[model samples]
Target: MKLLKQIILLFSVGIFIWACGSSPINNKNIEKEEPVVIANDSLEYEITIIDIGFNLFLNTIAQPEGYYSQEYLETRNRIFVTNWNIRARNPSQFNDNIYENVIDYQPNIDYGYDVNYKLFNYFMFAQRKYKMTLGAGYSRRIR
Candidate 1:
């Protein structure tokens, strides 16, 4: 649990640094401060490790020396503009950016006379001003 907390903090800080690195063009003529920009998105990454215990063996009894791991990662993103602090007379003074999404995944498998199981996952997400999306899907595989 402690490790998970630290990892979450580190990931959050890294994202903050990355977001602050870029600055859009500012309107010097505006006598007041401009509003902050915000974006939106959804993301998830998880790994569930199932125990192999000492359930004997499916087909062999050489004491499984191998293992299997599975992982999943998904994300969705959208764009928006809000809190436009305007000092200039022209509405054109607004400056905004678009939103997008990126996803990643990794899985590993190891085999031996006896078998085991483990899992590994790495993923995070951040969004400020956007919408939430949920949908339904059917499961099928065609080759």
Candidate 2:
């Protein structure tokens, strides 16, 4: 019994020592590769006026200048909000003057993804409130 206990104790100590002495798990073997950023090549804008429910009378407008800048974007957002309120109050009048009052207005600059997304959301709001069917059947392709 004495010999058996000594052997068990020795085995347990060996296991403990082995466990403690082992190398820690690490990701050193992983190769550190730099991320690749692909620049947009095409001049085509991803967000079309149609996507934002403005295809009725408005032509496809290019991204506004300084659209990437937060201040400029916020200013444009204010304009959109004001227009939205005006349109909401008088849907028929807004629709009639959309071509002359809204469509002709263009931002003289290019914008990136962020501005495009904001415009998209704003148009979506217009569609919902006005009960207009803009960009109908285009949802399936996006998915």
Candidate 3:
């Protein structure tokens, strides 16, 4: 009886150690991500985002295209961009690395659905990856 208990204890410890290993199998097999460009040729606006795992997040985690109306996306983007720009300007108060550049998103100009959708999803990816809130009043727990 004592021997069986000892064997079970060792097995439990081994399983625990294996579970707590630093690198997971999925992380080891991750593919490299390329920069994603958000552009509107007709409007002559372009933005390139180069961040690791953003592509994966965009495709796998974000809501599907057409899940949100363009107007809704634009409204949320306006709020997010305003807060992001504020952080970018005041780097001392926020993480300088995260808010490196200010986005030039004009409220009046129409960027079309693709541009707005990609931009909004990028903001969502950034929020999740950095674990920081871009728009405090807006919901950040989508995922």
The best candidate by TM-score is 3
Index of the highest-lDDT prediction: 3
What would the TM-score be for candidate 3 when compared with the true structure?
Answer: 0.75
Top-down TM-score ranking: 3, 2, 1
Alpha carbon lDDT at 139, candidate 1: 12
**Which structure is stronger by lDDT: 2 or 3?**
3
Supply the TM-score for candidate 2.
0.26
- Kindly report which residue stretches of model 3 are placed more than 4 angstroms away from their true locations once superposed: 1-31, 136-140
Give the alpha-carbon lDDT of every model.
Answer: 0.25, 0.45, 0.89
Residues 1-143, model 2: lDDT tens digits: 99999999999999999988835443332232222221223634333232222332122342343435655454555466455555555766667433223322235435444544456444444554455533533233322
- For candidate 3, write residues 1-143 as lDDT tens digits: 99999999999999999888867656655754578999999999999998888888888998999999999999999999999999999999999998999999999999999999999999998888888787845454843
lDDT of 3 at 71: 97
Q: Please tell me which model should have the higher lDDT, number 1 or number 2.
A: 2
| Cα-based lDDT at residue 57, candidate 2 | 16
Score residue 122 of candidate 3 by CA lDDT. 91
